[model samples]
Target: MVMLFESSTIKNITIKNRVMMAPMCMFSVEKEDGIVTPFHLTHYESRALGQVGLIMVEATSVTADGRISPLDLGIWSDEQIEGLHTLTSRIHAHGSTAAIQLGHAGRKAKTNQPAYAPSAVAFSEDEAIPTEMNEEKVTETIDAFKAAALRAKESGFDIIEIHGAHGYLINQFLSPLANTRTDRYGGTREGRYQFLRETITAIQSVFEGPLFVRISAEEYHKDGNTMDDFIYFAKEMKKQGVDLIDVSTGGLVQAPIDVFPGYQVPHAETIKKAAQIKTSAVGLITSGRQAEEILKNQRADFICVGRALLNDPYWPKRAAEELGYVIEAPKPYARGWA
Candidate 1:
């Protein structure tokens, strides 16, 4: 039997299989207003129809200033609710659970507006230096996350993922390289992770479903956070009601990383074992056999397929065929599977 085709439960939600469409930013909002367009509907629905177990929407900003790009989607205002609701409805129609990744770009936001971070640091020398976050700003961001979670719940999403990776705002705070704050929100591990811990708590207040946190497990620099740091971070996340850790490495700062197939699998394995929490492994996981091997060896629970799905919307369907698991195709496309 193919374990990759097996159903897995995260909290109260049961996904149809272990194949997940990893969240990839689609900078196609058209007007830079952060509203969902027809492009988003077609893009995401195709993956659900492809038989992906979980379809995680890309990083959506909680506030206008938090957007990674002006064209990125937003869950900030009430106006975005209807379109998001329609999106979830369509994904659910195809038998795949829909999820959204809520995030803030902070110092990395590629907008004309001023950015905010744990300290006044620039992602690079050429980028704008971000303003250090004050207590009021921290509270506002937390409230924004809370409000976004509520909006996600209203939009009928089955899960909510906190984007704490890829050198974004949350990652910026957790990283000592980016965050040089002298307040309670910086310095020690507990201090560095305070923002994420509180954000999770705030999200739980409004959304009571499967919650996943994506983290950059390795910063790549010798002085940057290592696997041991992530293990401890994952443990703190578990304590705050996080159900899964979406493991990816690098992007905390620019450094050379040895990239190869399944390079991030060991990081996921270490966090899973040390933190005793479920993890989703991502990073160059392009084939079904590779995904199956990861599960077979108990490295991770979910295989997050990113660029592979973008290259082939029916990648999951192909994976099912390769694994010899008869996954149900959409009624109109059923004959193709036959």
Candidate 2:
């Protein structure tokens, strides 16, 4: 079997293929209530029907003020569970495992409410200077993640991925460039990792299913996290029993980055080897052959397709064609797919 189409297991969940639909925020939530709308249902279900093995729902905020935008999906309230449950049910019905990305946008939040972060810094001049979180707020935010994980379990998600990358709440605490606190939560590298470590521990307390953490392995700034820093973080995650590391780069106070196909694969490979952990490679990986090469070489265990899937919900079928691999289609599309 082609490595890309090969089945893999994490915890007790088996994914039919290595293709994971990366979480991309729809910014389509109506009424500003943070609930999943019909648009989300159709949007995600179409990818499931297209035979993607793991459908990772977008960066859903754990609190109302933590949203990247007012329209982002949320898991902060129990009332939002029903819509997410329906979404997961639909994805599972189409033979795909459903996962949700639990996140808080931190200083990147674009809502009217004041944003919170590890320090009172602005992501950019265009963005507002966020409030520096105190010990009370820190504990509260960690509890929010734990609460969100419970909601994820209730929502019928098979996997829960903490959104620790992309200069968001967790990333702010992880990146020295973003986190400049003198308290226990900042200062040294170990201190910087404290927030994520606690967050992971908190979620694990309530969540026993497969847990994944996405990280920006390569922050473009000179003073940002080095590969060594990333490797240390990965090792800590491995010790914590994190099932996978979805590796992506940049987005922490972005500097100039040279974009290329599979540019980020090496980081994933390095982390997988150094940390002795499974990882998912993402970023500009737009073709089946490219994905196959990554898996065949054991660079990463899974491939996360983002914008490409947006362009084609049937991206897996297109990939199968490119790889000359005959992937089984949904019954109704069998004739056309064949």
Q: What is the lDDT of residue 232 in candidate 2?
A: 98
In candidate 2, which residue ranges exceed 4 Å CA deviation?
none
Q: lDDT for model 1, on a 0 to 1 scale? A: 0.92
RMSD of each: 0.9, 0.8
lDDT of 1 by residue, 167-233 (tens): 9999998989998888889999879999998999999999999999999998878777767778889
lDDT of each: 0.92, 0.95
Give candidate 1 regions above 4 Å deviation.
none
The 10-residue segment with the lowest total lDDT in model 2: 248-257
| TM-scores for candidates 1 onward, in order | 0.98, 0.99
- Write one digit per residue (lDDT tens) for candidate 2, span 246-296: 999988895888999889999999999999999999999999999999999
Clashes per prediction?
0, 0
